[model samples]
Target: MIAFDAFRDGETARRLAAAIAAEAQPGRSYAFMEFCGGHTHAICRYAIAEMLPANLRMVHGPGCPVCVLPVGRVDAAIAIAERTGVTLCSFGDVLRIPGSHRRSLLSAKAAGADVRVVYSPLDALALAQALPDRQVVFFAVGFETTTPPTAAVLARARHLGIGNFSVFCNHVLTPPAIAAVLGEAADRPVLDGILGPAHVAAVTGADAFAGFARDARMPVVIAGFEPLDLLQAILMLVRQANSGAARVEIQFSRGVTAAGNRAAQALTAEVFEPRAHFAWRGLGQLAESGLRPRPGFAAWNAETRFEIGDPPPEPRTACRCAEILRGLAQPADCPLFGSACTPESPHGACMVSSEGACAAEWSYGRGRRRIWKELR
Candidate 1:
């Protein structure tokens, strides 16, 4: 096992940063997008972007699950919460994300909807068991890392014959989102390499990024959240760019492997299947990128149990969250980032979650002067 403290050592981070700055070409730009919100948080929190060489740019991807979830989905969850005698449980991050007309589940709760913040699906399950008369719905939203646990809860609920408990599944896949970014980069900035999602890689494995590497010809490094890990991953990407080599490498081997956790994969497969198309806040619709309960677990599906109806017209254009999610714009570029949309009163989803790029920048990156300018 890799020493956790070793990844946090200042000297190690300095060494990696020096190596990166030394290897980075003079005029040639190296743009790498870290495709995980946790990594984004770490980079901003530690000022990793400021430490990087000018040639290497760190662009945030739509890795924040709450940030990427379209307003329509949030509206659907709100609809469930608004139902009489029904309880809606969601992760705290989703509570503040605004839906159509700037409504949120938490706001719905304030207006008399029964919404509760939960740490896990198990908590929702316990709520379900405790209040058998109430219809309990768990608003499950995340990448693969959190899907397995949601699956476990669904399986347990089914096994225990808990009729009132169901999940409003919004689980998304990572690789497909990466593909969506690369495949639709005609009008957007082309990425040189990717620092892949570390936690998602734990469940999906290193090889899961092979297809992206092969197709996009970009190096993918599954990196840990530590400052050292981010620095090392950037160094690795810079080296690959310098050498014109593209492949998927696992820098967070302490948590991820080539094959990943087999049992978790099996459990996920048994419980969930991909949706034909799913609406992402920024990317719009992408094929086979979302998950839903399998036929056997249909009884535990909230979408089928309740007709939440179609989402209202897309959220207003004042929020530039869609552009931020697609890497076309930075958080600072957003007009409402600090003025109209502080974390206390978020104008968009990106400010609602700490993992969101806008939130990370506001929390840690605001005071720092702009160190590197993108040459493109």
Candidate 2:
């Protein structure tokens, strides 16, 4: 077993902070994007930025699944939920995301739609077993890390011959999304290095990022979520940035390897195929970034079973969530950061998920920058 407490040791953090403040180049600036919600949460929860040098800064990426889910998908879930005797199940945070009509799963449920919060796809399968009279659709949404479990449950439902269980698959791929982000350099924020997502690496393998580093000429370090792991990864990235070397490195060796969990990847591939294109909230339509159920599994694909149509264009808002997701802006810069939008009453998807930049900033009071600018 791992002594997780060791990762959070205060003395270790202080030493690492001193080393980072010393090693990071003074005149040359380094801007790294952490491409995972777990990393963003850890950085915020531990006040990691306060230890950084003036020239170095961290940018949050569009890693939160809930934050990037397009409004049309949310509207589709609501459409399914509105049908008589149909129960739409999803993660809790997804319930609060406002859709095209400013409607949400929670609001739909309040209006007597059978929207349910399930912890896992297996739970949705079990719910379908229990409620044989109603159709149970798992409103599945996530990255590679969450895709395997949904695939596993689909396999289980097939084996058990569960007739009423289906999945509204909204799983997205990481590499394509990263490529999409880098491709937007002409208009969006550019990154000097990437603090790669460890959980995503654990599922897709560290090898998935090798092409990105070589092609984009960007340094990428696969990092664990712990504070110490993050600090070490930052040091490694700074070294690469200073040396003018761009390559893929692994700092979270404890959980990630070059090849990753092959079994999980194979399982996901067995159930899903690459979608031609999918629309993200900020990134628009990116080719092969999303996944759809294999046609053979149409019996359990909710999109095939239901008659959901394209939702109308979402009404515009003053929310800067689109720019924020592209690393072009911070939550503090948003006009609605605290006044019109909040966790209690979110005006946008970014405020709805705990991993979202807006929510993390609000929850952790990220405005108190003690070391980034003031001390330096």
Candidate 3:
């Protein structure tokens, strides 16, 4: 395991803040987006925003797989669970995301649907094996980091000839989503750099960011989840910007390598294939953004087993989640923020998932009244 303590000191954070403050160009802002919901949570939980220079700002991207899953998909999963012989399985975070008519998996479970929460795909697979007569559909949702494990489970199921096991693949790719953000309209703030997700890098490798760096001319830093790791990454980006250097840099070297985990990547390639297009709640349809089960394992695909179709009707109007995911607006800028959208009753995905930017803001009270009083 990587040593996480090196980046966990007050001195490191202060030094990084000073470096960033010194390099911030006058009248020019450095907008860096961290594409992982884990990073968003760390930023808010540690109040990293307040520690940065006024010219340096962090934008949240579509990092939370559960949050970005369209309402229609949730409804489809609910439908599967409601089937007489089907048992739907997913992470706990996905249970609360509202679908059409404000229905969610949690609510469906209360209505007698067999919706189960599993920490790993293997757990769901085992459950299917234990009950040979019942159909177990694992809701596989996540980025590259979570894909390989799911793939491994699928491979195992195939080897054992587990006929009742299937996967509702909602795995998404990171590169396409990054491209979508960079390709946003000119009116939006042009990002100067990106703090790439550390865990995702561990699976896809740090080298995957090179294409994005070259194409967008934006410095990409694979950052760790800890407070110090993020600060160091910010400082590194500031230095690169001040010196007019843009490239892919890895700050979380302890956990990430250039080649990444080859075994995991190979497993994912064998079990999952990229979809033509996938619907991201706020980013819309992105090419190759989602994954589907390979033909060799078609029998384990939930889409083929059920009549799932396109996404459901969008939530009510006035939800600024789309703008928020694109970095065009902040959570506070939304009309429903804190009023209609709280942790208890979230009007949008960003407020529902723990890694969501809006959820983090509310959880940590960043830029809220309490923090304002403390600063004053």
Estimate, for each residue in 26-56, the C-alpha lDDT of model 2 and write its tens digit: 7888899998888888899998987888889
List model 3 lDDT by residue over 1-376, tens digit each. Answer: 6455766788878887887787788778888999899999999988898999888899988788877888889889988989998888888888888777778899999999999898888889989988889999998889998899999999999999899999988999998888888885676557888999999999999999898778778889999999988998988888777777888899999889998999999999999888898999888888888999999988888998885777754665677888888888888888877878887888788888889888888888764665456459
Question: lDDT-based ranking, best first?
Answer: 2, 1, 3
Cα-based TM-score, every candidate? 0.95, 0.96, 0.95
**Root-mean-square deviation (CA) per prediction:** 2.8, 2.8, 2.3
Q: Tens-digit lDDT track for model 1 on 246-336? A: 9998888788999998999999999999999888888888899999999999889999899554454465577788888878899878777
Distance from true location, Cα of 222 in model 2, Å: 0.4
Question: In terms of TM-score, how similar is model 2 to the real structure?
Answer: 0.96
Rank list by TM-score: 2, 1, 3
**Which ten contiguous residues of candidate 1 have the minimum total lDDT?**
367-376
Question: Which residue pairs collide, candidate 1?
Answer: none
Against the unseen true structure, what C-alpha lDDT does each candidate score?
Answer: 0.88, 0.88, 0.86
- Model 1 has an lDDT value of 0.88
